[model samples]
Target: MKKILKQVTKYEKRISVLLMVLSLALIFNFCINSASAASGDIIYVNGSSGNDSWDGLSAAWTSGTNGPKLSIKNATGTVNSGGTVRIADGNYNGINNTKININKNMAIIGQSQTGTVINGTDSAWIFKIQPGATVTIENLTITNGNAYNGGAIYNAGNLTVSEGRFTDNHAYVAGSAIYNHGTLAVVYSSFLNNDADGGYGDPAYNFAAGAIYNDGNLTVTDSYFSENCAMYGHGAAIHNNGVLIVTGTDFIGNSVYGLGGAIYNDNALLMANSNFIANVAYAAGGAIYNIGTLAVTGSNFMGNVAYGAFYAPYISTAGGAIYNDYGGTYTVDSCQFAGNIPQDIYNNTEASSGYGSGVITGSSDVQGATVKAANKTMPLQKTGMPLIGFISAVLLVLGGSAVSKRR
Candidate 1:
């Protein structure tokens, strides 16, 4: 009886070990499947040789049922929320009859900025980010879009664009390249040759915002805007009815028929370390037209032109660099304005003021006088040292010697 009892105990121990092993195997299999699901969240889109019916799990074609999707639409639809859609280097066109709607938080990354192109073919807006969505687009060129409002992209959600190029997009009303109704951040991007012109048979129609129309919060850093035109509108490059912050940006060769060759601020605007060169406006404000609050610091404006026209009854030309309209509040700090045609700063406000080393040209009409200095220097921060002092310090650090001043 004792031997039989011991043998039963031994079998019971063996069964317990077997069950433990089986449980561990099942747990390991489940973890593997979970990891795979997480890894498969990223969908691939290859415009050249891809099939839409296949699972967009692989970058290259592996089998008849598993490969990259053909279009961005398919990849976007297949990707999970907060997933990424990787686009190959190819031109993607023929978007659906309606726009490509993105309703979830995701990222769309292109292989290269210049190699991966999304051409609208003058059809419709390419991507429409729906409300409550967050999207990030990187390293892509969005071009040739034609729409009545937003040409390239209509963003109603939070969007971040980096290393993107928006060119040759046209709109009839506003925002040739992008219309922002929510928070938007653009970094290391370029807007070129985008226009907001009047439609056919409407030459006298008034449009707005050649490149971007912002009715929400927008921040632009290290970007370039060039050759954008608002044919009969305000803001050749940007029209801001909300908060706008621009830093380390360049605006060049933008033109408008009405006001603000480069930017029109109807709400609040802040610019720092930016350059406005060769922008033109037929009516007023060659570089910027401010009807709201504007603050400029450490910026340079050169070669901007505000050419007046005799449009039937009146001639209006003012503010080659900036036009502070009546009731506007503005402060220019450590800004340099030079070589602007007609004037540099035209202030029609009651209490607009400038501080620091902000030097206006001889033709500026601010407070019925101009602020000009013979030995004008670049705009430097009040707390920052001069360039010569900085150079000397660098030399001392490098050579461990005192440098003689040559006057």
Candidate 2:
């Protein structure tokens, strides 16, 4: 009987220890799961019939909040899980003066692409993402903004824009449509009729990049830049001072005054399956101006024009497709340059005058050691827009003498 009691006590002790261990394990598991959990809310905004006092919950414009400001403010305050702001199909005006500032990790999505619009009223930017923020915008249109740097959107953090249109914006300095000081990814988007045409009289004023200015990592896929203009600067389409990778993008009808009618690259740039067509530059590089490492693969350049101002200091056309200067190295693989005016591939690195254009490589036509053509053939794409800005300046300079003689 004593041995039986002792055995039963031992079994009870073991069971008690096991139960305590199981309880501890269950508590630890619960704590771990709670610590890793995520929670947030989805907010709504309606522009046409919303009011500022309404709660951002209803999908109908009559009951939802009018603008994006309050919803963004609430989302930034939320902890753990990030927030999402869904906007309805209507024209929206930015709140908090002239711009809608975002300082949190949030997603702004539109109900429809063609029906949802964000208008800046030609006074401010539509969206400004601050540092340490992550934002994603999709299926919307941003238009009619005016600013010094970014007219439509200014990003100082990580930003992703998908399936959107940025049009009819103007900037006085750089990036008429968008300015990025951080990581930016654009997919299936378009930048049209944006102008970076201010800062004329100041000697330091070089109005660069009618569409975008990137000082950080930039990735563009299946995007388009069309009918953009830069008045006294370079890169009517894009100005890149950092790493840029463009795949399946198009640059059409962009114009500039100094160089790079389509793009100006000062750092690492890689373009694959892209198109540059009908771009005009008053000085050089109707397609691209590369001051850094540039690689173009499976791209096409068609009908690009590189002309000089007849009455200005520079009076020659060079590099109707690409003006590679500043000891910049470029590799063009399986790329085609067709019907480019004046010449193709203006290499200024090996100039006889030490500052002018240089020898031809892989082509039959050598125009007096001034312009070179890289013999290549490929197809092209088309975008709707008439060439205006810098080409008009070139024609005015050339035709000015004839008009004066007639007068």
Maximum-TM-score candidate: 1
lDDT by residue for model 2 over 1-407, one digit each (tens)? 99888656645543453344345435533432332212356667655555446556555544234333333334334322356778778776656324777777777788888888878788878788888777788998888888888888899977889999998888888898998887788899999888886375355867478899888777888998887888767788998887777888888778887778889988767778888877877777878987766767678777777785532422454678887774565656567766676776766644453443222223322233422246555444422223453244345434421111000
What value of lDDT does candidate 2 attain over all alpha carbons? 0.69
Candidate 1 per-residue lDDT over residues 290-386, each given as its tens digit: 8876767678777777775523211343778887776555656567777776777877633445421122322334543335433234553332334
Which candidate wins on lDDT? Answer: 1
Give candidate 2's total backbone clashes. 0
Off by over 4 Å in 1: 1-40, 96-98, 198-207, 310-317, 349-376, 379-407
> What does candidate 2 score in Cα RMSD to the true structure?
19.1
